[model samples]
Target chain A: MGVQDAEPLDVERIREDFPILDREVGEGTDLVYLDNGATSQTPESVVETMSEYYRTYNANVHRGIHRLSQEASIAYEDAHDRVAEFIGASGGREEVAFTKNTTESMNVVAYAWGLSELGPGDEVVLTQMEHHAALVTWQQIAKKTGAEVKFIRVTDDGYLDLDHARELITDDTEMVSVVHVSNTLGTVNPVSELADLAHDHDALFFVDGAQAVPNRPVDVEAIDADFYAFSGHKMCGPTGVGVLYGKRHLLEEMDPYLFGGMMIKKVTFEESKWNDLPWKFEAGTPPIAEGIGLHAAVDYLESIGMDRIQRHEERIVEYAYDRLTDHDDVTVFGPPGDDRVGLVSFDLDGVHPHDVSQILDEHGVAVRAGDHCTQPLHDVLGVSATTRASFYLYNTREEVDALVEAVDAARELFAV
Target chain B: MVGSDMYRQQILDHYRNPRNHGELEDPTFSHVGENPMCGDEITMDVELAEDGETIERVAFRGEGCAISQAAASMLSERLPGKTLSELREMDRDDVLDMLGVDISPMRIKCAVLAEKVAQDGAEIYLGEKDLDRTSTE
Candidate 1:
């Protein structure tokens, strides 16, 4: 509650690594980007790595016998290894599959596992705070399979109601999927405990780690997650690439999500045998350049420890929370504690989030204002929308000050 | 001072004291609409005159940003005595012109939500469309 210690991150030097941080928006105003939760700006190392790949050996992976193809394939495969190691997936590349984004990763599992396994009267346990990616996917799958989808209630203070989860994950629960961190509330759910509960119920544990893998230290094996999914764009990596880590046995047992050129072992006119793990799921040409960029992104994140980055975000979020809550007209949502992720969702007393966001944009401070792809959670919070300012390793206290000032400007304009 | 350019004086005034802001007791046509992207919602209710052609009374109830609520208020103030055909003819430009401000492309849906609801209500009332609600996504 008092002035905390300074974060142990050289944010200024880190800022220099991101060139766009030096750019301006709206008539020479410096950009105070607080939309990291949506998509993080790629650092120079990642951009350069992708550029180098394209500038040199650019070819289709896993097919050609030529030198360039071999180089591309090796780099692409190494990208999978890099991701697996970063997330502490002991099965390594054999268990990690590349998808377009976290949404695609969830879909892969839903198609390969959910459609095949879920049946009438079965249940899929999910959290109310889940993004539409996991929520809608499982919902539609349940509808198709005649399976029921139940939600774990979110507490008033923005936490997973573990008691509700315990009640929901009973004998008939087929899958228990939840977000490791709530994108809207920044509430870090107790995923390991949830995973253990799912395991006890004989349900497959799936984690939507889109917000968590990039912010904090994640060990898929340690958490004993059956499947963990995260996006590249949220971790200072390039778009069009994401990683899904599944336990080796589960992934090997599941059917292929897609079928095409590279994922088959032997194709006849009537039948086809699928390739080994991972490639069996990734159909056609993979995101070669984006995958390499993500490898570089992982390298960059590792260079600056994830623990330090987490601490830095905590400091910045705490500062923003303190500054914004200082005003009588502002109301911050989520948990009133220090253990949240590096973001804050709040509402102005009379102003709408869209208007508040427009005002913030005018002041060159970018924040997300909407349901944040969690409409059900917003309903639970009793708000149609909320203004969210998400932080990252590069975000600074000065940027938080700018966000508060811009919010003040919005409140003043609507005060009359 | 910063966001005043977008939230003009007229827009702010209408937003603060919206005109005809409530549900009509007995209305000929009522339609609910929303901009799902930003979660802005508006419900429009209209009472037709004795002739059953002109708008005898109009009221709206909803929650949204300054641009959306103000535009709804401004549109409600201009709805009396207008025929269903005229209401259906009203478009995005008419709503923007009523607000007297440049709505950014992102917030244009917010600025035109009420118009969509009112126009859709008139269309449904005239049996031109078989839709219950409208959305400016």
Candidate 2:
């Protein structure tokens, strides 16, 4: 396939917003960071956002009766409104809860919702491509509740096999948790279809949006998922901050995931009534600065528009696919189409992924090489590990060129 | 070029033709250790001499990076006559010395993965030898 021009993203102008982009690495080579699947470098606006919060309204939220507390509280709560709207959660701010990261968000639902609901003979269905955050939580919940765990096999072409999903989400299935996009394979699952199947079986559907939220648009209501979880850091926000969007009814019905200072309504010696919707789930001191930074991050993403970012990434992916596949020594993994996210998992013919990654790193290009937390998927793919190059809004076509050149160099280096 | 120095000729040679790499038939001890984070697996099999302390033969079978596979190959050449006690005394620095190159901290696990498997196999060998002694005694 002939490579087309990348979508117009004003990447140079956007790059200016991220200060780290200009930093030099490895004997003054520009950092060609392709590790977006792990975390994204925050723009200056997001940095200033959290700094301004600490410099100005540094106070605990919802408890103190002071001006600083109120200002911080409003900013923190507005993060929820922004995230809810960003994900198209029709329930709005009331449905969004903050946690440390996507792992914590999934655990909240598993412990509070799954533990309370699931029991013996119940099955929790999961896709084989789920990251450990999405997979292990359900496993823990299953162990605790004596609920059996079931899996929807990944298709040979690198998709959540919808046919297998239909068979797995039986009447006894209590929940179906799957990643919105396979972090390793870049395959975007048909989550709305899977959610529908879960609904048919009267099972709850949770989408792990850690890899999806930052890359593409997500609509929790449109997808009809009972819960959606994503990390702030992966979306140009700060670490120690994540958002979990649940159906308002589910949030109201489920027991509290954490219990302490902020989440209490009326706590006597013997009994305690939980606080309203989200605050009940967030106990202790919340990630005040991180949440505010996430709001700024949302604003930054909005200014660029997620649609444009996604298109830009898709164009980059197309060009990368062309460039990498043109090489005789490389074989790309995942579904054979443009339906994937802005990432590629591939391996050189004779180079182990770690060695390939080392060669890439030596050339001042960064990529992830390992099982990528989808061990089962890797096992199914007949590879112990794969080298993955994941892109985001800030990554440019030049970086992809750097990656391809380095990979080719790796092949040559190992040729002997 | 130094850019490709990490995959030195020695590393490449060992990876291309790993020494003593196969399953040992009816081995006295064997264990498969994995650096799960990097997806490197090294299964070490050892055939003990009648003395039950010397490794009469040592072989490895698994898949990993140049550092790991090459290190395993290097260890196979180094371990044939070493007694279980001497093998047990081998440590991270010794393995790094055997590789004869500077190993970055990040890739140290890859460089030492074979050593971990070999030591684990020897540990199990000791356990089995003691059990046999107890059963016979």
Candidate 3:
């Protein structure tokens, strides 16, 4: 599949931005890092932006009146605005809340919103394909509040069963929380349609956009989501930073997930009045450098254009799908190659994914093996585990070829 | 890459053709262990001797990578005829030696899941045996 592209963005130029692309592993085999879904490699731009912040204006934001504090505060607050715009968030700056990671973002909503709104006999809806972050958060909230959880079934080819989803999201449903993209299955869900469905039933909708935000364009307004959550590390930003975009009304009604310094306006010995919209949620000292780095990451993605990156990944995924299917023993999961995101999760005929990955390691080909923190999704797919190879802007067709070659080598080593 | 190393031919052989691979009918003791990180699970069952001092039989059922399954199969073969005390003294290094492969720190979970399950079951079996004896007397 040497199909030519329309060339909105030069992928070769994009690959040049990632310094890790030229790395060597093991005994000098060229590195083929395919674990972007776990964490994408950072570019020089993100590195420089964060480093410049530390060297130039390193101070606590929104606290000090010094020139350094003013500049740092501007950069940090600007990051929240950039991130909001990145997702096409209509609620804008007042909607964004920075947290530790996507997991923390989900916890904030579950603890702050779900715990307060949901009650006994109220239903929380979730798809079987949800990552542990979103699924476990809702489960615990349901348990604490005596609420019930309903699951939407997955179709045979790994798409969400809308018929089942319709049945599950009934009038009793208080919230509909699902992953926008399946991290292990590579299925890009219809977030807008699901959001519409959730709204029709008078239920709040939350999209775990952890995997989707890195691969495709996500317009929160268009989707009509009440809340959307994603992480920075998965999108080539530094760790310890994530975003939770909730509607202003919801944020105002809910209690803060964390309570401490910086989240309060008036501090008394007995009682404390909380801060406004975003500040009410961001407790303690926030990750200033990480917030600035995330802004740089958003800028990097915008420079390439999300649609172009999507198209680029589509070609690479199609090629990888074709290459993987060439093997008689391989079984790729999720929908067909055309329907998935930039990743492919699959298993060999007899080889376990961990063994396959270990053999791939010997070839300097990196892949994620195991349950992928979505064990229930793997259980739905009737597999204990799988090996996943994911792509990003820096990945190439040649890198996919290396992945196939390494997989072939693994098959040979494990062949009976 | 697997040339006579950790992923040896013998390990693959044991993995493909596991011995005593199913459960015993209402065994005296049974325990399931899982490597939560990798989702590898092993359920070990043991039939205690009439005297309750020894394991009369052992069987395991599991699904995982070659190392974990192979280790389970190999451990099952050696479990029968071992005293409860002997089973309790089993160590991680002993299982590694039995597998005849050098496992990495990352995969220590894979190679040791079976032993972990078995030893845990053995401990419970020994404790229950004492409790039964005391209550009966």
Best by lDDT: 1
lDDT scores of the candidates, listed in order: 0.91, 0.87, 0.87
- Model 3 reaches an interface RMSD of 2.7
lDDT for predicted candidate 1 compared with the true structure: 0.91
For candidate 2, what is the TM-score? 0.92
In candidate 1, which residue ranges exceed 4 Å CA deviation? A1-7, B1-3, B48-52
State the displacement of the C-alpha of residue A316, model 3, in Å, after optimal TM-score superposition. 1.1
- Cα error, residue A175 of model 1, in Å, equals 1.7
Candidate 3: the clashing residue pairs are: none
User: What does TM-score give for chain A of every model?
Assistant: 0.98, 0.97, 0.97
Residue-level lDDT tens digits of model 1 in A226-325: 9999999999999999888999999999999989988999999999999998899899998999999999999999999888887788878888888999
Instruction: Supply the global lDDT for candidate 3.
Output: 0.87
* Candidate 1 CAPRI assessment class: medium
What lDDT score is found at residue A271 in candidate 3? 90
> Could you give the interface RMSD of each candidate, to one decimal?
1.6, 1.9, 2.7
For model 3 chain A, give the 10-residue run with minimal summed lDDT: A1-10
Docking class of predicted structure 3: acceptable
Tell the DockQ for candidate 1.
0.73
- RMSD (CA, Å), candidate 3 to true, equals 4.3
Better of 1 and 3 by lDDT: 1
Interface RMSD of 2: 1.9
Runs of candidate 2 with Cα error greater than 4 angstroms are A1-7, B23-30, B46-57, B80-83, B128-137
